[model samples]
Target: MNYLKEYNELTAICPKTYIKYSEPMENHTFIQTGGIADIYIKPKHINDVQKIIRYAKMNEIPLTVLGFGTNVIIRDKGIRGIVMNLEYLNDITVNENEIIAGCGASIIDVSRTALKHSLSGLEFACGIPGSVGGALVMNAGAYGGEISYVLKNAKAITLSGDILVLNESEFEFGYRKSIFQKENYIILEATFQLINSDPAEIREKMDTFTALREEKQPLEYPSCGSVFKRPPNHFAGKLISDSGLQGTRVGGAEVSKKHAGFIVNVNHATSTDYLMLIQHVKETVKQNFDINLETEVKIIGEE
Candidate 1:
């Protein structure tokens, strides 16, 4: 793809410090295996983001949005047109019982802030590895709690550069899904409603959750957390384990020995390795239990 014209137009919108051509996806993703993006930029502010959206739309460039490089797999062929990494928009503020954070703010940071303010709602996110926008978009949850419980509202921008604010009801949250998934909108910020609690108690709860994650998850290896979602009445990990697929390896990608839920980069794993392992696990589990396993991780980019 010829990106020279688009590059010039986008560069005019933001400083050179925020723009790059052919940025490596390996450097941004958690699993660390993918090709380069034709154009990548980190918008320093929301206005800059709006400018880029307008520019991309005006130029007819395919635009992709990235958060903190967690919970996604970009293919070997990488991405075309423009890719915007929202990491620079990291900002968090607390006003009484509400905590407001930018799309790029790390969930860990948000959880820490919650602990500082003796907030109880974000305890479920202490161990989550993605950004605020990602958590809201995927309806991320753990330890019997999910984002839908605390998220009061979210602000997002559309493909055509129109900004919209969605309340809880419009969020359409349901088991790892939000309206953001169904619409082409880029999340800008999220407001979470938390309750007052003893700081000591909040800290204890966070510590317990962290310990559990360490014990059950394959934290030692680079991975895209859980590979599949929980089936209607059964757990994905238990299903894979029951099928004797734990510790299974394909290229460098393996169903984690520590937890069958995660597919880890045990060696020099490529995106293809991860994809193959996922397909193999799905097929194997389907044949064994007559139930199809659906992936929870979002896979994107070209082949």
Candidate 2:
């Protein structure tokens, strides 16, 4: 494609710090079920990200940002445009009882850092399989704690190429949603406020949460963590379980027996298979419970 040619030319002129022409979305996502991206770029620094965004905007080329890919599903037809990966932006620093983390930094890393510093609030994120940026954008949560509770502020690049810092209130975080969902902003970093606690106690809390996840989740399979958002006053998993959709399969994708909330790639599932399963689950739940199940996982690219 001409776009691929343009992407190559641009990467050739860019600094060596960034890597260009990566691979399939499956390689990056937790579910391992997506097609290839035409042109994948990994920006080593924040400036590199800005430059790439400018280039794409100037040329009217499509651009998509990928974090750790824990909560996203790229389509089987593959992504047509530049896929910007911020994996190299991973950086974390702790001051007092707060943490400053780059968007690319893993949530697991942030939680471990908090544990090292005896910070208590982030223990709930230790088991979450996402990067800081993805968590912030989705307001990712587990075990009753969420990003909005601890996030102080965030730095993001606007679609028009302006960098802005927004406080937690400005993001308007609510139940697996954030302002980033509405605005085409690229998150750069976030700061979080934590609480002082004993190191041993923090470790114990993290361990308990991790153990709970291990016992309850299908950690053995490749899958997006939670397929559906929790419906009002009710759990998505309970609804699916009540609908008799547990262990349901479409191709190699199946509703996880261990956790009804997850749709796992049990045996080399294609992206189409996974998506079909997701649709079936949603339809079944709606038909049986009369509650519409919204997806927590972001679906991207074409069919």
What lDDT does the true structure give each of the candidates?
Answer: 0.91, 0.87
Give the per-residue lDDT of model 1 (tens digit) for 154-273.
999999999999998799899999899889679999999999999999999999999999999989999988989999999999999999998899899999889999999999899999
Q: Top model by lDDT, which number? A: 1
Sequence-dependent TM-score of model 1: 0.98
For candidate 2, lDDT tens digit of each residue in 82-125?
88888788899999988999999999999999988889899889
Q: Where is model 1 poorest over a 10-residue stretch in terms of lDDT? A: 8-17
* TM-score on alpha carbons, each prediction: 0.98, 0.96
Q: Residue 162, candidate 1: how far off, in angstroms? A: 0.6
Q: Number of clashing residue pairs in every model?
A: 0, 0
